[model samples]
Target: MQIRPCADAFYASELEPWSEYISGQQGKDPGYDVLGWMIEETHKRGMEFHAWMNPYRISNSATAFATSGAANHPAKLHPEWTMKYDNLLIYRPALPEVKQHLLNVVDDLISKYDVDGIHFDDYFYPYPKGGVEIDDAADYAKYGAGYSNVGDFRRAQVDEVIEKIHNLLVAKKPGIVFSISPYGVWRNKASDPVAGSDSNSLQNYDDLYADVRKWCQNGWIDLVVPQLYASTSNVNMNFTKMCTWWNANSFEAKLAIGHALYRFGVPAEGAPYQTLDQLSDQFRISRSNKNTCGSFLFNATCFNENKINILSRLAQVYADKALIPVIGKESEAAPAKAGDIAVEGRTIAWKEQPGMRYAVYTVKPSSVEGKWDAKLTAVLAEPSWLAPGAGNYAVSVLNRDNAESELSQPVKVD
Candidate 1:
């Protein structure tokens, strides 16, 4: 689960200070403090939590600039690091100082928080404007060389930032995962076969200077969640075709598809709202690919809307039962033993602690050797269960974020 802290005053003022304080309190509010709270909560429920962050976004709108407090204000302190193309302001990714500052922010988060992973979404550089170029002349004059054009310079800047973040995170905390969610299209096939998506409008590689393929091939991220927001029948960009393309192109890291549920029933003057079948078809394609690990919905609010019974369909198909998402192989920890277990009618309860996500398992008796095969039966959000059934069962709890515990002792169910 990815938790988005409200981008309002309450969070911005506390981000840096909270980072410092989280290192001391590990268990009390494991899933709510800074970024650690979310991870801790996910662990409690036997689910992995990825720390989703925006690298360059400072503020939503410049209008809030005046009212923002002094300590939490990003634009006021670093005016040179910002660019105003038309009216929209964006962080300047072409500066070395900019890269260093962003990396420091990420390091701070990782060092202080017990997180499972670090994630970046589709905003590397700002969306492009017609004739106006990003104001990076001062930066280029200072650092640009050998590179023929400003495009390469911008690409190099983004690459350097991502490379540094990846290395530092793995070195400091090898248990945490790193992932990126780039725009659906890399480049049009007309530009280069291996360059980008089939869409004609914009490319992340050429326009935004985000070389997602290079990052994947170089092992800079543990997973790639490309936002394939189009439908299979769309003339410009087909969702199904793009999923197959991404699966083929992904280097070694896991590939997860990003679904745009926000646009489920949104209609324009001529184009009709997308039907439920169109959305379901995309998931069907993703499930078929072995390389495709899983799928992530765009925003939590949109999913909560339950548009056209979309959420119901998704729950019925993808999440009929709770699941323990695949963790990074390198971060796997030894399973822990199950301690005391008690049953009260249908409700089973146990002691709860920090850094533990509980999974209940069942074992059957057999004549063959190694007959004790354990299958995951339930993931408990709390340290209790009211499951309906009578059977022999054993409960094991694993640290979902760190995967650092042994399987618990078996408890029988009558």
Candidate 2:
């Protein structure tokens, strides 16, 4: 649940001065080493960490420009390689070199750190504005043979990068999950009869060239968290209706609704800030969907403000207990064995070794057969006590962050 700022581009820009300055003041940058530290810290606090990375976007506003250095900046260094359509900045994804470079960045992160997953948000190709077009003519001319038009070329470009990234990630680290948060609107009903959403706004497929449907069908990503950040009555994009639409369309991968808790209680003209009731309604809808895994609130910082008492209510609902979001079934690895189990009166304890977490199970005697029934009692970051009068029990050690682990040999108690 970490809100990652753009740091890889900061390093690529050779703005070591700014990078060093920020790292020195903050004690660490959000690069591989820093992210690794954060993962360990979050795990210590009984939470899982996902490394969020934006794929094709280099920078957005002037603020990013100001923080960046001149000579080494991405736009400056690769002027011809950038697309400045509608004043939004985007790297030319059609270029093989650009795709390779982005892959290299991901490769470095995956190889170096033990991150749970690689995350990409809704900025696929810059949202098309007015009549302004994404300038990829030069790239298309250079690499666009066989494709009929620029649109097809652009779509193919995104597809190629996504497929390559997915394949490489699984190959390098089969246990790590790959996820994307594409723009909620896959397409309008007019465009595709089976489209999940009906927004008049820019579609991930039509405008951004992100062919999200194809990605889902191909199973390139482990999860698809669409950003359904609109109110219920907004005729163009009703949140609840869209959530159901997405769940219906998702192709076997985990589907988690990106809850817009940030918009809760914020004032706006016409579409005023949503009330707590509206937020609750969205949660209920998500829960009702059988295919839906769970929910992740956008931007963790939003919860800190306690706006409209949402955090208090959320904490009440999810106190003490933490949920380990289900990783891809294929990502599960062999379980690790529990070691050095010890007892002190009513409390039993054991070491949660590196790469393994603890799951305490209680055993009950079978009425009919010699076999005993084992039930998972708790999945925790640390060891804990068992109830008194336990007949037989075993502790299963799991990967802590993921549910992949082997059960420890059953211990007997009289």
Candidate 3:
């Protein structure tokens, strides 16, 4: 699950320090903290929570609606680090101060919250404007000594942020995953001989100034969720072809498809995701591919509206519990086994590692063996869990990289 923590000069934070970014619901006597509730609820459902942040975007419009609170926004405070183009305010990535500010914000999210990972989508350069060029000429003049091409310079600047953030995140929170969801196509075959995908779509490398392929090859991020937000059957922007290209290019990071659930049944200029069958085939393609780790749907609210009965169809794919994949090379040695499982009524308790999560599994007496084929019954951050009902339960320690330790002795439930 991706929670938009910082967006459009406002945030979903309750910390008094984040008052600069209001949720617009502050007048309810108490400020609403969306991040807190999201984490708790997502965990309760045994899902990993990824906090998605738009690094540069400030105000969507420069006209300045009173609802935006642009006057006291952090961008206003650090006007030197911001650029305005096409009615949008973007933080200039060339500045060291801008990187530091983003570092601080993300560090706060990782250190303070219990997020499993931090996600950044492909909004690095604010999707280029046709008539207006980014106002980073001054920045380029000041900091563009070593680089000749301003485009390459901008790409380098974004690279610095990703590299520095990855370093800092690993240092501060060793196991926290850092990921980037850049635009789907890195480059067309016409652009690069090695680029695999065949498309005329806006390339992230050329247009957005994001070298997503380099980030993957450099092993800067733990995962990459490419926004393959197009119909699977669309010839030029074929979803399965894009998935194949990305999976082939996944150097050291896992690849997850950014599914377009919101686009289902929605009309588009050329092609439309007008049927649920397109999505079903897309899921089938992803499942068949060894490189495709998972899917991250675009918007969470799509299911709430029951649009075309999407929630029901998707539920069939998500019925079974799935664990977050651990980066094998990044994981630490499995923790010591969970000690002495004890159950009273429906509650179960056991010894645990300080920062590790525990996975509870239930196996039928007929199926019990050294190898447990059953999926996890529950995963809890705390040492204890309230089992859903009576069953033969066993516990295992999940390490920082989400690697599971050996299971503890099973304790029968009454």
Residue pairs in clash, model 3 = none
TM-score against truth, every candidate: 0.82, 0.82, 0.86
Q: Report model 1's TM-score to 2 decimal places.
A: 0.82
What's the true lDDT of residue 208 in model 2? 85
* Total clashes for model 2: 2
Specify the poorest-scoring 10-residue window by lDDT in model 1. 4-13
115: Cα error in model 1, Å: 2.2
**Tens digit of lDDT per residue, candidate 3, span 107-131?**
7677768887888888888787788
- Cα lDDT tens digits, model 1, 1-414, are 433221111122233222212333211232443444455666665566677777776545455433532344444567787776655556788776677777777776677666678888887767887887777888788888878998888899899998898888778887778889999877788887765666675788888899998888888887899998877777677787789778988886779999888887676412423577777788899989889978888878867787778877787666545444554446545555656678888777777755566777766755886456666678766778876688767676766543434555556667
Q: Please list the Cα RMSD from the true structure of every candidate, rounded to 1 decimal place.
A: 5.5, 4.6, 3.5
Poorest 10 consecutive residues by lDDT, candidate 3: 8-17
The lDDT leader among the candidates is 3
- Tell how far residue 96 is off in model 3, in angstroms: 2.7
Candidate 2 lDDT tens digits, 1-414: 423343333222222112333354212344554454677798775566677777766546534554543445455666665766654566788877678777877787667667778888887777767788677777889899999988888889889988998898878887777888887888888777665466666688888889887888888988999988887777777787788888887885789888777887677623534466676677778879988887878777676787778876676545544436566645555566776777655566776576566766776666867556677666667765564664556777666336645556666555
